[model samples]
Target chain A: MRTALRLLGGQRFLVAPLCLLGAVIVFAASAPEFLTLGNVSNVGAQMWVLALLAVGQMFAIVTRGFDISVGAVAALSSTIAAHAVNALGPAGLLAGPLTGLLCGTLTGFLIGFLRLQPIVATLGMMIGVRGLALLVTGDGQVVPLHDADLASWLAFDPAFGLPPADWGAIGCILLAGALLGRAVLGRRLVMLGSNPDAAHLVGIDTARTQLRAYQLCGGFAGLAGVLVLLRAGTGLPTDGAGMELQSIAAALIGGTALSGGVARVFPVVLGAAFIQAVLTGLDLQGVSPFIAQIVVGLVIVAAGFLEFALRRFQGFAFHRRSWT
Target chain B: MTALALPLPVRSAWRRWRPGAAAWTTLGVFLLFAVLVPRFASSGNLVNVLRVAAILCVAACGQAIVLVLGGIEFSFGSSAALASVVGVLAVPWLGPAGGLAAGGAVVIAIGALNGALIAGFGLPPFVVTLGMLMAAAGAAASLVGGQPIDAPPSAAFAWPAAGSVATIPVPILLGAAAVTVLHALLSRSRLGRLWYLAGANPVAARLSGIAVGRVTFLGYLVAGAFCAVTAVVLTSRVGSGQPNLAPNLPFESIAACAIGGIPLAGGEGRAHQVVCGVLVIAMMNNAVVLLNFPIAAQQLVMAVVIIGAVLLQNAGSLPVMLRRALTRRPNA
Candidate 1:
């Protein structure tokens, strides 16, 4: 059971179970409806978009880089996809995600290949890409997809008596786990992230590996954008506005190192779930939307504190060496 | 040394004025806009450019100080937002001057928090400042209840965009004054020496009796002051303290300074370079505005330029320069 928990990975599992169970126990003790399957599934369904973004962000963070442009990229893909739906019918949906993937990959390439600093490079992308998104949408959102079928189905459909989006999110995590744990490219990505200099010395094309990280990340961000659009049935500017910060928080909460090298996909997936669920719970509890952001800020502070504490205890040293 | 042999000081002076390639490229772009775009050459537009660039320059200057001390700060946005929100709110009683003072003080407090966390407690600046960034943003937004507060109706505030002396924008004047003072401080003062010492090698500086932590704290304090001044100027200019005004500010300033030649790894850069960088970005934005490029076009151009600027800044030293020169010499 201990190894199961450990293998399920990192400290991510511990936090979510503890928090979710605590919420359940408290709410159940008080309201009795908190432990219901209906409420739990609702929480999972709602976390779909943010959870996807967290997966993309986890990749960037685990590779020892950061992506502040996810919000912009995601927004661009979602908005563009919606805007193009009028032209391409079902095919138009692909337009936004493709553009999003291109932008994401290019941004990653700029950071990885051009030797530009990750944070600054992504910051530039956040500015330029967001503006580009606004431009593509003519400074307005595509409020309704020309064909909203796929979006509607993704948002409202149920599969095997579970919310489709929630199940889809779980499936995405499983795929990511396979790619990262069992694939050769995944191992190379891990090596490049853990120690680029050493990887280069060992004949690994570190640059290629680095670029692939961004490419893979951007593709996911693009897909996440599509998922968001599908869920919302439209594209909104604010969709990606501050999502990067949340994504970073999600990845960190899931126990991925910010400086990159170690990863536990299941934990990050759960982390994303935790965020969505927590925010949903707060909303249900009658917390105002704006004020609830304080919770996010608090969570981020807590994560930083945890990182600092872990560093102080030298708890990460063992893991750090293994990955490198 | 023989007279024909270039005096080392003279050689170093030449190096200082060598005009970095990025500097020249950006300057060339500026000139092209001035010549090609009539509106860009107008004094009014030029002053407006200065005015806009002044906000960035002020923020970047603060950022440059921290960068110079071998760290980075993202709390500039938060500090500016907090000060802008709270300082102007105080203007009903405190007046415009009070707004400036209050803003400066609040930013300093934020800066002190960042410094204490990073230097005093031995925390990473990225984590400390990132945390402070969120906290400051939240606190400021909450303080103002997420609304805009009108600035004091003081024409005295206009002095930044256009000082009493005809034709100078107060922002430009203030930014210039700051650059001068900071430049002198970096070159002449004991504190500047300590900052340089710490930035160059924290361990060595500590070993040599330099109070590295205090120097870091001082750097952040100065950064806070710089942000405060920008807040005051921006509030005065915009005629209100909009809580979300500094949304892209931290990134803009860091990019400007970085594009100008300041490396995030720290040490071996000057504040003056940041001024040049800020001007380049401001000019680019101004030119785009003058040209009436759509927002998307602007973003694309700006992103490309940013990447180009980063590349130019990171290009190799004299040896590589010589090799390039030789390669070009054959063509010329």
Candidate 2:
């Protein structure tokens, strides 16, 4: 019984998910319309974007690096997509995903090859990409898309009561999970993150592994941006504003260790959903949007504390003994 | 606190001039801007740049101290916001001195809370400060109803920013005074050595009988005091208590420290390096504005410079990091 209780309190099963459920139960009880089908779909739509970003965030976090520039990449990708599609028609659709891929690859190359610290490198990229996005838009105006059919197909057309964006998010998560779990490259990346010195001794290509992880992260962020553009039928320079923080919060809350070498898909996705649901509930209750931002920030710190406490309780000692 | 004086380690004077690259780079960048951009070399623009750089320098001063101790205060920006808001609002009832006290008290209280959590409870500095950032911002918003508070009609309020001593702007003079005190504290005082020792190796420092927790706590306190001081000056300069002010200050301040050759891993940096960094960023901003570059281009250029500076600073270690990854060992 004690063993079963211990197993039940594991990171994968408890902590974040319970907090999420607690929030949901409290909010659903308070707000009558929170559980409505329409509201549920609305929450689902919001969850998909953040969910995608969170999954991408997990990749970077697992490598002990942060990709704050993901938000900027999303903004740049959407703007580039809007311009390309306007100029070349359907071929522009290819521009969105490709832009994301190329941007990710570039970030990976810089971080992996140049040995730039993750936070500093990604911050530089974030600022640069955001600037480029604004430059493309000119005067911070939104880039309106003329491709209505594409927009409808990407965002509005729902099959089996779920939109294509949700499907895309699910697909990305599945693909990422498989990459992290089943692939040889993914295992090497984990080992690289777990102990760079050990991995080096074992002849693991740490730099290349870092490159692949960041590239994948960038790709997801870029794809997320394209989805946003298609849904809104416009590319706003500020689309990715505050998203980097939100994604970081979600990924951390989902239980990805900041020191790297650990991640879980379900927790990350659920973390994103929890955040979205809380925001939705707050909106329904007429709380200020700024308060939501505060809540998100607090949630991150709270989750960190919870992780520390859970680890202490579980007595699962790792290589690094110090919690802080 | 008195035990901080019990430190003696044989060291050369070489570490004092360690951040020479940043200082030299500032000079090089200044010359480039002076030649390329018209009016950039003019005394009027130069003083204006100094005035602006002074504010960032003060904030970065605190950040430099924290970095030297292997911690960070991400909430400095929000701390300034809250201080300015409370300071301004309190001026009408408490007078200028009282208002300043109120602001200082609030910051000190927040600092104590941060110190307790980080030092006593072993919470990570970044997470604690990040939470503080949001909470402070939210408090400021709710307190002031998201509106800018005008400075109280008092001579004390106007004197801080408007007054000058012997042709130097008061802000510049205050900035100089701050730098002098901080530099002395970090280099000449025994407390500074404790910070360096603790940051360099916490376990060793503890083994050497240093109260690492107390030192860490004091570092946060000192950082908070500087940030509070910055808020006071910013409030006086702008002549208002705008809650929205300095939203991006912490990022720029951290970037300044990084460019000044302060390692994020900590245990090495000086007060003068921060000033050098602030000047570099200020010159860049001045150049962009003078050249009439688009806002977008300005941001891009600033980002590029920050990355370039960090890369240059870490250039020595790059080869080692790369070789570690590329090296192949024989069978384990």
TM-score of the second chain for every model: 0.87, 0.88
lDDT of each residue in B162-200, candidate 2, tens digit only: 778888888888778778878997999988889899888
In angstroms, how far off is B137's CA in candidate 1?
2.5
RMSD of 2: 4.2
Cα lDDT tens digits, model 1, B271-293, are: 66887789888988888777898
As a whole number from 0 to 100, the lDDT of residue A85 in candidate 2 is: 84
For A89-177, candidate 2 gives per-residue lDDT tens digits of: 86786677687788788778678878776766887788888888889888588888887787778687898777776787788789888
Q: Which portions of model 1 miss their true places by more than 4 Å?
A: A1-5, A8-39, A83-97, A315-324, B1-12, B156-167, B200-210, B314-332
Instruction: Evaluate model 2: give its TM-score.
Output: 0.91
Residue pairs in clash, model 1:
A64-A259, A64-A260, B160-B169, B160-B170, B160-B171, B161-B169, B161-B170, B161-B171, B162-B169, B162-B170
Candidate 1 chain A weakest lDDT stretch, 10 residues: A315-324
Going through the candidates in order, their DockQ values are 0.31, 0.46
- TM-score for all models, in order of appearance: 0.88, 0.91
